[model samples]
Target: MKPAHRSRRRGAPAALRWPAIATLLAAAFATSPPAAPPAAAAANPASFAANCGTKPVTLQGYFETGFPGTVELTKLFTKQYPNVTWKIREDPFAVITQDAPLVLSSPNPPDLMRTPQITGLVKDHILLNLDRFYKIFGWDKFPASDLEQLRVDPSGRPQGVGPVWAMGINYSMTGVFYNKALAAKVGIKLPPATLAQLDEDMAKAKAAGVLPVEQFDSAGNGGLIFPLQYLMADYTIAASGSVQPINAWVLDQPHATIVTHANLLAVEHLDQWIKDGYFNADANAVPYSTMMARFEHGQGLFIFDGDWESGNLDHNFPGKYGFFLFPPLKAGGKQAAMSAPLTYGIPATAKHASCAAYFLNWVQTNPAARALNVAVYGSNPGGPASLPIPPVKPGTVTAQTLAAGRVIAKEDGAMGFIANAAGPIDAEAWTPAVQKLFGGQITPQAVLTTVQADYEQELSAP
Candidate 1:
């Protein structure tokens, strides 16, 4: 589940206003038909305003209310085009993930919606294919892997590869958040470059009577799962010639199974961490918020989380903390970690499809929007390869995260969340089996066997 209280930028209030897009109208001088095709109407603010005419367009947008970037961007969009009204409905991601298909399938679906339920939405033909807009807005230049997350085959059986069905406004990745003071206290000089070094650091922290790791297992076991998923990603991508088998398995492609050597090792490592007391003794008892609160209070040496927490870390901890992506087992191995798009897609039932598409394109093509994404959202707007990385303020956690994300993105090593292999896979199989492993109720191999059974059952059903 997406955390609700992750809104704060730590100690400081967020600066919500993002940079403005530079005006770049292709239609000028004695252009015959304009050298390049005009940018999508929604992407160009002036054109959208002029084309909107006198009709008042209330864009009904369904989004996870917790996302601050969407809200800030929407405010900027509406301010520029007052004729376009926004009727934004906020909902929890869990509710949206389960209910989005039915809502999108309804006759009067919202014009633009955040689609987490990619399975049913694409299968039901609810989302618009964005291939055309991709060309028009020059989105083809961004990393294909980043765009692939939104892609789905015609049948929607596998995700993360296929035609463009959605667009992400920004990108995020999973990594480790370290308390610098605690690291020094534990006699660690640099971030670990290999799993062996990390194990040593955890041992040092434990020996010094500090919590080696602070993870909240009571809610979703995200603390345990995120790092475990990252390690599995590194193994799967590096150890195979065809990452397809593993990739397909994670997406629940037909005949995919989680019972593999790499996955088994990942589970074994987590079990060992539990035995070594790397995590809090009462980890399963603490909620996610309390986990973050304790981390902020410097109770632990490391907290494995995504760049989504960069904003909070910057505002609260500032120079006191540092962030790094989880290292591979081999010192020089290709690094892989879980990453997801802050994605948005237009529904086929959208009344204002053009307007929504324009908004999507603008966030992507607009420099100001990209800057806002980096600055306010603490996320990298996976822009065209030609576009230079935007300026993130120096000496901030967001800057540190962006630097680490660039390294992994360059290696083409980012992967999808392991739990997202199937919609029900996490709650039904992964979480329960993980809890059982923590409680000694199951063995490492049994955890995979149990989750594999759920994967087969879910994917096999019509």
Candidate 2:
């Protein structure tokens, strides 16, 4: 979920925004290729440091406000390289999703930016392709799945193919987070091993008068989608033995559909949970921060969220929480979760594009930067698989999440967020649709059909 920050403009309707975005991108990029550093920088890993130059250079950055990892890393980089400094503007993730096109096409774009949906941006050449840096930095040595979501073909249809367009400061994964004390009170001695066991656990929590699940589903940022997608992964894997279908749907593969038997079953399960009062009654009104606050204050037994909050939970209420993957359908089924990079990209028009790319590489490979990423962000500081994950204190929530991320890596079950299926899909489609579902105004099938229709319409836009 995005941090709560004031949006600069009311979100423009997708119908109105896409045509304007396409026109702006055409004007911004035209036939010009993205700028690159000297050929020597591409030829040798040692020479890549020279691309930023020794002069005083301040890279302009656009970042999401809530996460401290990026800001901290910028300060560290400046300390290490006194010749470099940063000028960063931070906003909530929702605003960035709505404003990415205008921001990327501006005359003086940020040298580095947190990217939203990139199919349109990549197709229009608004985002700089990072294939050159990929070779120079040997990022290919990291797990291939770590970089797959950032790759885009020339036409930008299928996402997990072709050249890389972005890099992650850290890779994040989402699952179930439970209050340890609350769980024992409800008699859930172990994390559920299957969907049936999970259902029984929620029932026990409800019977004990504990709020079963603390979730958020406000108008623009629906957190319920986290569990919904996890359920989808469970059902999909149970039936087909893989989550590639769901990933394919997220990546915008040809003829891919979210209206599948697995997805329908997932939505139905979510609906049943809502009816069983597993979720808070006023969940529709709650924002991400409110849910976080409520769960930390010991109001709920469980909350579904991402590893980004692991560090925060560890700091605020140490040793009180536990993390687990949303259980699979059958006991031994392969587990999956919405896992992907906190992707940052350079603009085609950035003045310090080379320096921004250098920072991205350094974030992964530099020991200090990687440690900051792990300690502050509580995510996998994605570098080569051989690089040890910075030591996390045992029994901390960060430690559990890091270990869970390894399970995901070994299973190859990393999936992108369904909310990111398109540029406006979350704000305009999934969030509103899920809000209606929470209010009992829509059926389980309607949620899938409604979002799928909006997704198709948005993708087909000129």
Best by lDDT: 2
Top model by TM-score, which number? 2
- List ranges where model 2 is wrong by over 4 Å: 1-50
* Candidate 2, run of 10 with poorest lDDT: 36-45
Model 1 lDDT tens row, 1-462: 235456553434434322111123333433575342222223222233313345788889999967877888888877777887888998988888887876776667787888865765677677777765666566778888788778887677787667788888788887898998889888986678888889889988899988889988775544567767766766666567334556677766667777889878878888899999888878767777898999998899998888888887887667888888788778887777677888788776566776788788777667878877777778778778677768877878899888888887777767777777766777788777777777788999998898888888877777
CA lDDT, candidate 1, residue 345: 80
CA deviation > 4 Å runs, candidate 1: 1-55, 219-222, 241-245
Local accuracy by lDDT, each model: 0.76, 0.87
The whole-model C-alpha lDDT of candidate 1 against the native structure comes to 0.76
Looking at model 2, the pairs that clash are none
Clashing pairs in 1: 10-312, 10-316, 11-315, 11-316, 42-358
